[model samples]
Target: MSQRPRPCRWLRRPGSDLGLRLTLAAAAAVLLLVPFTVLMLLVATAWPPLLALDAHLAATLHAGTSANPALAGVLQLWTDMFAPGPLRVLVGVVAVWLWWRGARRVALWAVVTMVAGGLLGAGLKLLLGRDRPEFLDPVSHATGYSFPSGHSLTAALGAGVLLLIFLPFVPDASPVRTQRATRWTIIAAALIVTVATGLTRVALGVHWLSDVVAGWTLGVAVIAATTAAFATWRGLPARRSPQGGSGRPPPRDMPGRT
Candidate 1:
């Protein structure tokens, strides 16, 4: 008889896998649903706190737009680069490259995470039917329902997925200090990209501050869920060989296997 794979240290505790999964599920639910609820409240009643913050940001950022053409130009460039179309193209390229490198599962996860984030953002915008911020003159034009900033959502999603995918490449045998430094560097870079993308959306007056917040929250939830799922899949025991011995499965070229 083949022996079962041993559980990890944490899983060896009282609740085991069920407890870990439930914890992840609860965290994901709160991260995903709370932002959604707040968005609905904003849509249904124009929640005062959110509205006031949006107005203040718009007034502060939109001031002197005409005087700082260069700054406006740079922000607009960042906005355009992180927009849905360009982001999709970038995701596609990364997916193709990963496939070429034989990391098909990682590639698929990245693509799905990004595409799902975009679709979710679009669906929420349509359902809420909230209008873009018009409290001040928009330095850049945007046409769509604006309950959630798509650029912010996709940027966050991309940053998160990329970070997770690359994290495993860090050598486990490295000195603890080196590992810690590398991890922090990766995290900082991801945060910078995600925050910069969201800030540009608000700075341009094309999206409300609440819109960006919801986008960031939702994107993080998606990343968390995907990470949990992938971990579960990886932890599954390898199939037994026909010789009545357990062994790892033979590698195969399976696209979108995740």
Candidate 2:
């Protein structure tokens, strides 16, 4: 008698690869880091035992109060407005708005990333109720808490969100050359800005390094969640067409079509 065939796996589903990447990103950002951030925040807030870290850092800054204002002031230039973070987010938003144009789906997510990141950062700040450094008058002041640096969170979330937003269109299915370049270029740029903003806070003495770390973690988590949702939404079964060869299709199905 003929042997029975093995059951088919669900590996060949549409967007499966993209789904996997999304899953990986989510796990890395949320599972691995977010909880740790929460713990750090708690330590920074509840564990009066841990509160000693803040005290120590505060003392260090105080000791060096006259160290170098001119240098800090220079580094503090454009970064103070959160341009290092939100500015990049804005660039990503513009990409979606310009290239994707009327494509509501893409545009909406860019907006979602910017708004959600801000909200999450603020919410965490208030929830933790961690105070800002008393070392100097804040170049900027936020009324809420400050365990996780909002600038860092904003930067990380912006980076992650934009990366995911464009991941599906990376030209893998159709084999385009520049798609990979463009995708990577965007990712690299985002990382630079995100990291810079986080570090800026530390240099400004506005927040401790721990705050930046936590904010970065949470920001990454937010993007992961967004990516998973986007991938799931796009992963619904759809037949691939080989009619087009240059990565994207002809203008037929696009806006100006009959």
Candidate 3:
């Protein structure tokens, strides 16, 4: 009769398997981000028309700018801070702080993702060399070529990094995904911060809808790649130390055995 290997005395079943499962999920998620990256690549082709998309988005906002005053106010705050100013700096600091607390690897990934997004957006903007809105009343003022909005790029990068920071910790309950309250809360916060901040660009009249989409695409791709790398590294469980220093002795309780 075959016998099952006993669960390691020191090993916690679900938590121990978590790294491997998360790595797989991160890999799968990275595959998903590829299409988004392609779309961002296509931004070069479609960028010229973004002025029109911006106009449409602006018209919609202008038509009924404040359906939910409270919500509008919240969104307004985001719009005000869409630039690479003090607010941006504050956000950057918070993101870095988050990465340092529980997961240094993740925090580093966030920084990489942001830098990647910024560089990608800059290159695309220069290549496209597109013009800004012909007639403008943007909530935020902008100069130079416009297409993939820098504001949107930074926001997406920030959000993507935040999501990556939080994703692994969530109680996935499905073999690998951990679900802890703090993780879920942070995940929700990250999504809110990213989406809200990205939209602020549109409201402020700086970026077209297409620009945000592209930024989101590129940002997600960068983050996915970062997460995939982390996942790959973490997939391997820690080996029991020499002399089994890290290993725990067999459990005192045995099934149907005294």
Candidate 4:
């Protein structure tokens, strides 16, 4: 009789995979904190050069968009679609689906990342107490301290959560044409939504370039940190199973499974 495959030892104890998890955590921290810290300091001090650039870009985009009604309308529509509220709702639905599918860790990660990103952005905003740029003829308005754009942060968090959770299901090499096409399509779509969400906030006169940039950085950091934690929980070198390559524990080993 053939022997059953042994469970990966690393998955059972986090200490076994300490080095890899620490590396991932450190890299994520540096990427998130270094530039984000510098940006915060510059904004706090109201650095002349940074402020000038912020004002110039904000004004230029506002002017161009104001002149072209159709372009402005499009930007507005894009922003509304990816706004924090809608993104949060979408993430919530995704979390529910993941939970039902028995990928509980992934579902929890998604919720935690999204909530953490939003709270971080909101906390920083209150700390800085920054004001939104004022335009004589404003194309749009957002109420909040504007050092970090909420919409951008939410979009990035939502997109990152969905991408990481679903990516493992998409085969790297598939014989089916539709399956192969979907490989890159998901990644490209995520990028477009995240980037466009930030751009629209600036173009709409609702947020500064720095605000949008900070949001993107913070959101990505939260996603990375949470993802690393979950990866550590599940162990590295994810198991391959009939369902697909997944970080999730095998259904047979899962809690409450028969």
| Winning model by TM-score | 4
How much RMSD separates candidate 4 from the native structure? 7.1
Per-residue C-alpha lDDT of model 1 across residues 1-258, encoded as one tens digit per residue? 422222121112133465576477557857787766767687569778768888898768777553588988998998887777876787788778777765666676678778778888899899888888774345788899887888888888888777766665566678999999998998898898789989888888788878888888888887767655555554466689889777765433232222
In order, what is each prediction's RMSD in angstroms?
6.2, 9.9, 9.4, 7.1
Taking all chains together, the TM-score of candidate 2 against the true structure is 0.67
Best by lDDT: 4
lDDT of 4 by residue, 18-48 (tens): 7776577659867897898899999999999
Output the better candidate (2/3) by lDDT.
2
Across 133-197, the per-residue lDDT of candidate 3 in tens digits comes to: 43343444668677667766676666555455445433334443344556667777767766776
CA lDDT scores, all candidates in order: 0.73, 0.60, 0.57, 0.79
Ranking by TM-score: 4, 1, 2, 3
TM-score of 3: 0.60
Model 4: how far residue 6 lies from native, Å: 19
Pull out the clashing pairs in model 2: none
Model 1, which residues run further than 4 Å from truth? Answer: 1-22, 64-66, 135-137, 172-175, 233-258
Clashes of 4: 0
- Of the candidates numbered 1 and 4, which has the greater lDDT value? 4
Q: Backbone collision count in every prediction?
A: 0, 0, 9, 0
Better of 3 and 4 by lDDT: 4
